[model samples]
Each structure stands twice: as C-alpha cells, then as structure tokens.
Target: GSWHPETGGLHEAFGDITAILTMISQMDQCEAIICHSKGDLHAKTYFSAVAEEFGYALYGRTQGLRNADNDLTMSQVTEEVHDISQVFTGAFYDILADIFEDYCCPEKYDAAETLFRIGKHITSLLLQALLKGPSSNATFSDIAKLMISLEPKKKWKDMIRRQFSVRGVVGKGAKKVKAPVDLVWGGCHCS
Candidate 1:
C-alpha cells in the first residue's frame, strides 16, 4: 500500500515500516542474483520466475512475523526494527522538509500527500533503473534521465530537467557568483 499518514495509528505505522523493510530485503535478493550472474538475461528471467513463485510466500512470512509481534506493540517490537523505524521516519521528515522548501506552490499541495507521492515516484524510478541494468556505478544523472523519460507529464519532465541541471560557484578576481554550471543531458553538456 502507498504511504498515507492519516490511515491509522502506531500499529499501522509499524506495519507499513515492516512492509517497507520486506520490500527492501526482496530488492537486495534480486540485486544479489543480478550481480552474481553478471546481469545476464538468464538472471533477469530467473528473477522473474522466482518473483512469481515466491512473492506471496515472502508476503506471508512478513505477515506472520508481524502477527507474531502482537500488532506491533512498542514493547513487542524488536530493538532492530524499532531502530529502523526511527531512522526511516527521521529521513522521511527530512526529505519532506526539503521538498517543501523547494516546491513552488506549497499552498496547493498537502504535505503528507506530496511526501507519499515522492516516495512512490522514487521507488518507481529505483525499480525501473534496476530493470534497465544492474550497473553498480549508475549515477544520479542516469536515474534522472530515466525518470524524465518515464514520466509522462510534461510539467514533471521540465521540473526534473531543471532539478538535474548542474549548479556551482564561479569566482574571478575576488568575485563569486552562483550559477548554472552546466545543463547536461543525453551525453551533451551545455553552459
């Protein structure tokens, strides 16, 4: 399920955290498979097959684990899970604050909903990048281009393009200027 802050109380929040951890574990497994196989088509095909067969099995195990925690009572949550949840929440809040600062029309959006959509979009971009190639050295620009290409909305595409533009400080004769260092896209760099 998508991230919705208004959904429930602490119990639901714990469940969502548990689910996110499970998904991360699954992605780690897939990444290992890809790396071990040197990112061949056979590896991708095998992952597809494995995902279809064991996806529900993993989900069941996650649910059972959650259920065993007795609805994620604070006292029942393991120390590790508790720590992870804290870190995740802190990071979410930090990112949300950054987005709010950067957003042009914050008044037009709900903070929680915007954060949720950002989370979903980032997840989608990550998975799409993995599917494109299991390159260990994939850069931010690579993912940004993928996002720009996959995003259907022109406004979002423009926003992404602007976001990815290079910015740096230039100095000459004791003068300093903050400026767009370059606008790099599709292997072309412009300043």
Candidate 2:
C-alpha cells in the first residue's frame, strides 16, 4: 500500500513520531545527556518515558515506545536530522504562503503570524523544560512546573497550573447548556 500522509499503522506512525522527537532532542542537546555513558539504552529509556508522559498529557494515551531495533550511528542520525529539518522548514514556509494566499485579509494575516509566534514560543518552552529536567525519568509534572515558573504573567501561570492539574480528566464536570444559542458569523465564514 502506498504511504499516506494522514494515516498509517500504529507502529509505523509511532516510529516516525519517535524519529522526529529524537531529532528534536538532539537539536536541544537532550540527546547528549540521555546518551551519556549508557548510549542507546539511556536514550531509549528517556525517550520512552517522555513519549508516555508527554503523550498522555496531550492525547490521553500512554504509548509504550520500544527501542529501535536498528539504531543509527550518531553521525548518521545527525545527518538525517539535518536533512529532515531542511525539508520541514521548506515545506512549512510553502504551506504558510499558500495559507496566506487563500486567506488574503489583513486581520487574517496578523492572526496567522501571531499563531506562528505562539507555536514557536511553546516549542521553546518545551525545549527549556527538557533542558531543566532530569536526564532520565523526567515526568510531565516536572515540565509543567518549569513552565509555570517560567511564565511571566501570574494569570497565565495560574492557567498553566490549572491545566496541568487536570491533565487527563476528560469532561470531568458537567457544563450548563444554555438554550437558544445564537450563531453569529461576522464575514469570517465563507459563503
């Protein structure tokens, strides 16, 4: 079967996700700490824990990632990561340009730019959390605490804390549904 961008077997999808995370860890200098002395064993353990804890927080699923059967050499991994990064950057900008063209409005342009900046900020905070946490057995709570501490605004810090406190509770409390809801579309929805 041909490879599809949106769907794949669980193992295949997990492998690709792990590869991307591995590359990111390498870029953020986490690979060095995880691979110190213990090599692939430590890397596997660290990444497995990260995938499980971080994955559960984000998706409410604990993925038990296994060690790569054929681990790439350090140099090889570095080269592959570099290539992947280049391809990803090029594709990202191309998509962004297409999006800007499709939604040609000053307000939409500002919103898109703001979204990109927010994504970058979140990525930086994740990397910072990884850097500050323990080399092995770093839980999501550790990362969340780091984020709370790093957040400048008290309101945002409180929000982060609240979010972390309810990591996996899916709709724990019932919400009051208001009757006769009004749907207002202010020229934003395409006719």
Candidate 3:
C-alpha cells in the first residue's frame, strides 16, 4: 500500500528465495547447489542452468531482473523493491555460499546432504525472521536486529550477524532504507 525501500526490498527477497527453494525441492540432485541458476526458459531447469541471474528485468526471457550475488549497499539502492531486495537477499545467498564452503570441499563429507541440511537451516532462519523479524516501518537494520534478537545462540548466530553486517544490513551504523507496502507484486515475468 505504501512505497518504502526497506519493506519492498525484503518482500522481493522473500519471493526470490521461495522460488529458488521450490526449484530445489523438485530437483533430486543439487550438484551445483552452491552456484547454479541458469534462468533458462524451462520451468524445471532455469533454477539450475542459469547461475547468477537473480531475476534480471532486462532482455526479458534471457536473464533475471536481479542478482543476489551483487555487492550492493545503501548508496547503490535505486529505491526499487527488487534492487533493494538484493542487498538482504545477497546476505542470505552468502550464507548459503559460506555453508557450501564449509561443508562442500575436498573434505567431501557427503557434501550434497550437508548442503541440504544447511540449506534447510538457513531457510528456517529466514522464515523465522520474515515472520517475526521486524516491526512496522522496519529498515534493513531492523531486519538484522530482529533476526539477531530472535535467532538462537548457536554457531551460525555470529555468522548470521556477519553476513548481514557485511552487506550493511545490520545495526544503526548502516544506511536506512525506509517505507513498506502492504502488498508486493513480484513474479518471474519470464517472457
């Protein structure tokens, strides 16, 4: 209902993450689980074939409108929901990357299973945060603070803080993205 950078972005992130998670759920194997996103035309393959294409709005059917791997900051945000969403989404994506780094390597300790396990945990935390992470007029910092406050004191706790912190999503030190719409309309729109 309103136009707020912070809420809009967070809403976008929720859509992207949920779509990716759904794609992963349907696939039996997640070989490139850490880095695989083709953004292909095929409903089943786009999630795995196109890597790094996080919903590019240009070139329509060719790429995604956003990229979670993008290194965006407050200054880079364009006040667009998708653009702003990338910042927080990037942090979540990085957490997955970090988990991949930790569990998927020469160590080879059932990397696939570890990836899924960690992926589930990350999704759980994300959902928890979304459900009760922030309050009215929440900003990027609010997300981090809320999640940090609600998050259990476990190994990933610090990592969670660092991920958001690195992306300038945590604490009052970072720039604030404001506003929040009650309804957020986002979809593949993949021509």
Output the number of the lDDT-best candidate. 3
Per-residue lDDT over 1-191 for candidate 1, one digit per residue giving the tens place of the 0 to 100 score: 12211112223333543344343245455355335535331222332222233445666432232221111222222334333233222222232233423442547754333434454654564457446732433323344456567766676555554443321001121112122233345664768
TM-score-wise, the better of 1 and 2 is 2
- 178 in model 1: Cα distance from truth in Å? 25
TM-score of 3: 0.70
TM-score of 2: 0.34
Per-residue alpha-carbon lDDT of candidate 3 for residues 1-191, written as tens digits (9 for 90 to 100): 45567776777787777766654453354445433433211223344222334344444544455555556666677777767788877776666666555555545545455566666766776677767755555566766776666657555667677888767777545765444556667867889
Give Cα distance to truth, residue 27, candidate 1, Å.
22
Scored by lDDT, model 1 comes in at 0.36
Clashes of each: 0, 0, 15
**Tens digit of per-residue lDDT, candidate 2, span 1-191:** 12211111212323433453443333333334224413232233433233455456766655432222222221222223322222222222222223323333546444334334333544565457658865543333445568667766575555555544443211232122113223455666667
In order, candidate lDDTs are 0.36, 0.37, 0.61
| Inter-residue clash pairs, candidate 2 | none
Each prediction's Cα RMSD?
A: 20.4, 22.0, 7.4
List candidate 1 stretches off by more than 4 Å: 1-109, 134-136, 167-191
